[model samples]
Target: MNPPYFSENSGCKSPDQSALIARHEVACNLTDISKCAAYLLKHSGRFCLCHRPERLCDIFEALRKYKLEPKRLRPVVQKDYQEPWLMLIEATKGGKPGLKIERQLIIKNQNNTYTDEFRSLYREFATF
Candidate 1:
């Protein structure tokens, strides 16, 4: 954690900069984010992402357009029966087309209780 590395800037410095662009879109949009990752990754480099479910189609399309193949996908929801508001994905640059859809992640039980795993992950937090 160096000061210069964290110095506040109006825009991102490089396409290789990960996470920040995807999370904040501060200096770019979704299209730019995918393009940046594609440019920064090698032929088989992997990219992991968590994004709003509404953007699922867009995400897939972008990845394909950039030659980043979707390899895995998982939906995250609060309850087993609830619609997923977020999705987790793993894509590989120049990877094969086969995709593995992982099991859904339910953060809470039907009674709205946090699962043991989530409780452990969010230790010391009163509410989340």
Candidate 2:
């Protein structure tokens, strides 16, 4: 036998129309003006890490198209910091022309603190 229709169940009065009305209700509840604006900004692809004047123009265009004021969007600047690996490389190559290579294994504890154990290897070409 074919599966029973969902509308024929005891609670459903008008299955087709009831489903449509339920969908409209869900959609209405899910719509938030601020979240919609944020989604538009993310999807525009005009505002990203490329710090160019022309890209700023494109971002302004997207803002205009969405009927949003340009002043509402604030630009955030991040300071670039050197990574530990680069620092290690710089220290290794500095004064001594031939030095040993060393590595440290870091372990994290349950309290979110770290402990390091050092290991050393000799390198003929590395500056100490």
Candidate 3:
């Protein structure tokens, strides 16, 4: 609605529960996001999201709490030798549980070079 009207607030804006809930954890957290997704998605509907790699447990915990079963997961790394900085996941609302974790996706090489696969993946957005 109205292009979402992105605004300014620290998620701690006074007298604005909606913005607070949306921007900060003042009234919301991963659980709230999962609940909102649960409300918006139909049974068996698929929901996917990308998040920081360190929050895997939080994401999984919240999704399960909302009856959303994680189906697939992929780690996003900048180099083959480094830890993942991002993670991608797909879940099904009210579906049976069976988490399928894919192999780590190495975005770059040891020398900070973009791998062919990574370049292909982001070809449209890459500059060189």
Candidate 4:
């Protein structure tokens, strides 16, 4: 569930409705998504999603509100020296209050080349 990362009141509107829905909270927000996940998942089941780093606090609050405790987080960074641009999160239904923050996943090297790990992860996919 790569849910919309933007707040409905925050961002500029897009003329493209599809793109707007995909990126903005036109249909559902994080709390709504988290609630659905909490309802659907069984005990110990994992709910995974990729989202913007800034929404981390909101995500945590939403997950907890619905009893989906955040268990793991993997920060995805463009370079090793930079702060995370994206976050890969895993929450477990009825899980305890423990969070395991994994190592940062660097997307590119200092020279602007894609990192080996990034390339390997998408090796089977077609690039535009």
Q: What is the C-alpha lDDT of each candidate?
A: 0.74, 0.29, 0.77, 0.92
After best superposition, candidate 4 residue 93: deviation in angstroms?
A: 0.3
Residue-wise lDDT of candidate 1 within 1-128, one digit each (tens)?
A: 00011112434555555655434445555566578889999999998887877667877897898899999998888988889977888999999999999888889987788887667867887676
Writing each residue's lDDT as its tens digit, candidate 3 over 1-128 gives 00111124332365767755454455556776789899999999988887767567878898999999999999988878788877888989998989999999998787788888888988998686
Which ranges of candidate 4 are over 4 A from the true structure?
126-128
The whole-model C-alpha lDDT of candidate 3 against the native structure comes to 0.77
> Evaluated with TM-score, which candidate comes out highest?
4
Candidate 3, run of 10 with poorest lDDT: 1-10
* Top lDDT hit: 4
State the displacement of the C-alpha of residue 33, model 1, in Å, after optimal TM-score superposition. 0.7
Reference-based TM-score of each model: 0.69, 0.20, 0.73, 0.91
Worst lDDT 10-window in candidate 4: 119-128
Q: How does residue 1 of candidate 4 score in lDDT?
A: 77
How well is each residue in 44-66 modelled by candidate 2, as lDDT tens digits?
Answer: 22221212222345434443454
lDDT per residue, candidate 4, 42-71, as tens digits?
999999999999999999999999999999
Model 4 / residue 107 / CA error / Å: 0.6
Give me the runs in candidate 3 sitting further than 4 Å from their true place.
Answer: 1-27
Whole-model lDDT, model 4: 0.92
lDDT, residue 56, model 1:
73
